[model samples]
Target: MNHNEIGIEALNQGEIEKAAEAFTKAIEESPKDPVPYINFANLLSSINEYERALNFFQKAIELDDTAAAAYYGAGNVYTLKEDFMKAKDFFEKALKTGMENSDLFYMLGHTLMKLEQPKLAMPYLQRAIELNEDDNEARFQFGMCLANEHLLQEAVNIFTEVVKRDPQHADAFYNLGVAYAYLENKDEALEMLGKAVEVQPDHLLALHAQKLIQEAK
Candidate 1:
């Protein structure tokens, strides 16, 4: 196989040194090719070499402006570094390249959420869930966006689905309890809060909510 293929195989097999070596050779052999740069950047990111990874991603982007993977990789590195503004920029650039994937949408949405732009985050998170219905984390985040917008009923529906899909999701139950309480359904709120605590005995929010509701009654 070619060096790039070999590098990818090594990366998948958890052979970091071999992968790095193969990717370096690939870059040496095809200096103008963006693919090798993107692959190497991904490897560097996996190993927490954030600055080096960003350099490689930038090289790939310079070689090919339409290199969506390079943009996405840089976005991920920025996110890991907690540089949400840069992450948001790179992720949006990836989208502008016509990349439509659950992960890309999810990351962009999550970055917007980190920036406290939940209204802007909602559509991307919704698209992420639509693209991959089994992604409960994306669904949960979408629910959070809805709740942040004060669309509590919509948030409740989304959280309910999350708990149905993953019964051990303590946060979903807790959110459901909070939503029900806001909607003035006292008994249901208490029951959902109790379930949250049952699923995760140390869920402090759920415990606190339960105490408040009981004392109010």
Candidate 2:
């Protein structure tokens, strides 16, 4: 296989040094090709070289504006750096390049949520779930967006689905308890909180909520 393909395989196999060497060779062999630069950027990102990764991603974008992967990679780096606005910008650019994938939508939605724009995040998170129904994290985040908007019943329904899919999800149970409490179903809330505590004995929020409910009785 070519150096780029070899680099990708090595990266997938967790051979960091081999992957780096292969990617460097690939870039040297095809300096004008954006794919090598993008691959190298992804490698750097994996190694936590955020600034270097962004530089490589920018070089790839300079080589080809249509390099959607480069934009996505840069967005991820920005997200790690906690630069929400830049992350949002690059993610939106990725979408404009016709890259319609669950991950891209999820990243964009998550960035929007970080920016405190839950309303804008909702549709993208929903679309992510539509594209990949098995993504429980996306579903959970969508439920969070609904809860942020005070859509308690909808949030409870989504959180219930999350717990059903993964019974060990303590946060889902905690959110379910909170939602039930907001809906004034004290018994259901306590039951859900108990489940949360059962799943994660050290869950501070579940413990606190349980204490509050009991003291009120």
Q: Which residue pairs show backbone clashes in model 2? A: none
Candidates' C-alpha lDDT: 0.97, 0.96
Regions of model 1 farther than 4 Å from truth:
none
After TM-score superposition, the amount by which residue 112's alpha carbon in candidate 1 deviates from its true location, in angstroms, is 0.6
lDDT of 2 at 187: 96
TM-score (C-alpha, index-matched) for candidate 1: 0.98
Instruction: For residue 188, give model 2's deviation from the true position in Å.
Output: 0.6
Candidate 1: what lDDT? 0.97
User: Least lDDT summed over 10 consecutive residues: which range in candidate 2?
Assistant: 208-217
lDDT of 1 by residue, 79-114 (tens): 999999999999999999999999999999999999
lDDT per residue as tens, model 2, 1-217: 9999999999999999999999999989889999999999999999999999999999999999989999999999999999999999999999998899999999999999999999999999999999999999999999999999999999999999999999999999999999998898999999999999999999999999999988886
